[model samples]
Target: MDLDNIKDIWSQENPDTTPEISLENQKELHLPLEKLRKNMRKEFWSTIVLFVFIILFLTFVDFHFFKFKIYVITLVASMMLITAFYYYKFFLLYKNLTSVDFNLLENLKDLKFQFKLNEQYYLGYYIAFVPFTVAEVILIFEFIPGWKNLTGFSFILYLSIFCLLMLGALYVVGKWWFQKFYGKYFSQILNLIDDLK
Candidate 1:
């Protein structure tokens, strides 16, 4: 066959797969996407408010040790910074969902990818606090006179156990939290994509 014939055959076989979304499908998608965006916004604002409350509480609460206060404030500040970073990425996804110009199939695929990526970020956000939790535990042991009785091998063993338990709990909780807040919407999107296929 001539090159022109081959080209025509190829074009026919692989017609544009990413078509514009129909008004009906877009309307169907509107609810789930809006729910996801709404939940994200609520979570973001709640986090900000919770952080503010924590800072204020720490500032006003009496602490016998100045070092403990400083350490906790610094830790909270660092956590806020990390949370802000993740939220920025989430905001980008939110913006994409809001855009009117996206191609249907391609955009759905991209959004699905973004959702999976963000789910990892969500888990990482929790896991990232492991070190901070350990530090806080150390601080508690140091500042609280009652906890000082643990020493040498006993202290190390207890700390190790506590950290392990905390790590597992954080992972489990992170998964549950993500599923509770966002998983349904993600599943809905996946179903929509399947329908398109």
Candidate 2:
């Protein structure tokens, strides 16, 4: 193949016919994949750690150390599940982020698709917390074996106070964090779409 001659002809093409997903842009994107993949690997391992810790902790609670202790464990279990769920959501997002490569037309589409998936992931995260937050309150006061002292009224009062405090703090932190991280990325994707147009 006459590579030099092919480039000479290709470079002279009418600009209007070519889409904004240009070859140069795609080439630049390839450099980031390794970094993205590294992040994905880190996320994967962190999730495994969360899983193991939760299981081990629940096992400890099964030994029935104290009546009130189980409530504490139930709280811990709820927190762990919530933590693990959010991380898993991030893993899904990062997995898509890592797979993007702008080296081809299909890859550009893939990048956009990946970002859309990330958006859904965030919405899903919010939806999941709803049930988790509710169940955590319910489990603390209703379920969880070995209940003693603490009147049902007192139980509700203390549990509501503690969970509301934790949930509020977590919500604030999550809002700030989501805006700091995912919000920026999603905007970047929108800009990319504009560039593509």
- For TM-score, the strongest prediction is 1
Across 42-114, the per-residue lDDT of candidate 1 in tens digits comes to: 9989988998899899978998889888998899889888888988988888888788343567777787788
Quote the lDDT for 154 in model 1.
90
C-alpha-based local distance difference test score of model 2: 0.63
CA error at residue 109 for candidate 2, angstroms: 3.7
Q: Estimated TM-score per prediction? A: 0.87, 0.57
Candidate 1 Cα deviation (angstroms), residue 152? 2.3
TM-score of structure candidate 1: 0.87
**Each model's lDDT:** 0.83, 0.63
How displaced is residue 17 in candidate 1, in Å?
A: 7.6
